[model samples]
Target: MRTVTVLGAGSWGTALAIHAARRGRPTLLWTRTPEHQAAMAQERRNARYLPDFPFPEGLRTTDDLHQALDGAELVICGIPSHGMRAMMERVAQDFATRDAPAPMYLIAAKGIEVDTLSNMHQVLAQELPPSHRGRIAALGGPSFAAEVAKGLPTTVVVGSEDAHVGMSIQALLSGDGVRAYVTDDILGVELGGAFKNVIAMAAGIGDGAGLGDNARAGIITRGLAEISRLAISLGALPATLSGLAGLGDLVLTCTGGLSRNRRVGIALGQGKKLEEILAEMGMVAEGVKNTKSAYRLAQQQGVEMPLVSTMYAILYEGMAVREAVQALMGRALKAEREW
Candidate 1:
């Protein structure tokens, strides 16, 4: 069996580790928190994140980075986007000094970095040595952690600059209840995963404000148009935007009650402060942070992402949610262009 290691013992990371272990791969899950590691080791469940779901028999948990990474043939990074760079730097240090072979990397985290505005793959490329860069891949789509851990039907796509790397990830992760597809459009996949969270937040805000299904649908549809435009400006294929990573993930996150980003938006629309909402949720809502990054990136690339811009204002500049909605509705009328 291929030995796999998953960094970050959060819900998504734990779920992916469980899936891999159930597929008969020898999998190890790493958590930086010693308390979390102890809890998982004793209870066989991540009580903090994935409390109800017990880990598979074949899976292991650890706090030591070296022990977790030892002999790992495949490394799936489940760390959140904000901390990914620092985590990768640590990983690179280990790779440099350790005798263990470098593993193929599959990044499952979604979102652009806050300050650098780099995608997860870009963060990996920047932190890891040049020799290790070519082995990186990204996995993204509409799959949720709870459903995936329950072994419900879930499908996702893996993308890489190297076609073989994408296919290798697909082969390693695809099984009875999990489906994996391969793509060479890494830029499209990464952009789709990161941008949809921003749109989901907008959709949630509409729902929270009782704007009705019409308003919510409008946000989702227009959100896709904005994402596609920005992604194309960044050299992503327009067709990839309409596929699972784009439209599929967007629809699920915008409508699904399980979405942390959508829940954050809901709280915001209900008149709760962003700080309070985040404190209450205790989970990383990528959209809240990604809003600023996406907005900055849109400006940098000269892409018109009005919804993203409005979200940035609402999130970072203290603009009222209703006022933001009004601004969106009051925009100058123009031809309905998808680009």
Candidate 2:
């Protein structure tokens, strides 16, 4: 049996660990805090992140990163995007000091880095040795942690610079309840994952305002067009935008009630203060950070993305949601299609 390690005990990370163990692999899950590690070891459940899903019998929990990863065949790094750089630094140091290295690293985080404005895959490449970059891959698609843990059928994409590595991840992770597809164009997969959170915010705002399904559908459909345009400018194939990582994930996240980012947008539409909503949720919504990063990227690529720009303003500049909506509606019309 192969050994798999997942770093992070958040809902997503726990769900991944459970799934890996259920697939007949011995899984090691890491949490940064010693308190959390002690709790999971004795309690057999992740308290804050995934309370309902107990850590499986085949899963091991630990606070030590190296101990969790040592001799593992595949390491699933599941930390949030904001904390990624620091975690990667630890990973590199651990690998460098090891008598021998183990296997490829797979990233399960979703969001663009707020500081460097880099996607998760780029951060992986930047942090890992050059020879190991090819093994660094990303996973994104139609999934919510809660649903996945309950044995709901879920599909996602595993993207790497090397198709062979992507396929290996798919083979290891996909099971009866979880499905994974592979891609060599890592940029497209990462881009699709990052931007979907931003678009979900707009959809949530529509939901909160009680604007009816028409508005929500409009936001989802148009928001997809904007992402497609942006992805094309960044060297992604057009068809990738419609695949599981793009259109499929967009629909699930924008419409799914489990998304914290969508909840944050909903609160905003209801006229709640951002600080209040963030405090209440007490988790990283991701769209809250990705809006700024994606907006800047759109400008750099000369990609026209009014929705992303408007969301950024509402989130950062204290603009009202209604006014942001108005700005989008008032923009002048062109031929209405990008070739």
Give all candidate RMSDs, comma-separated: 1.1, 1.3
Which lDDT value does model 1 have at 65? Answer: 95
Listed in order, each prediction's TM-score against the native is 0.98, 0.97
- Candidate 2 clash pair list: none
> What would the per-residue lDDT of candidate 2 be over residues 206-242, giving only the tens digit for each residue?
8888878999998989999999898888888777789
Candidate 1: segments with Cα more than 4 A from true spot: none
Over 232-262, each residue of candidate 1 has an lDDT whose tens digit, in order, gives 8988898788988999899999999899999
Clash-forming residue pairs, model 1 = none
Best by TM-score: 1
Worst 10 residues of 1 by lDDT: 330-339
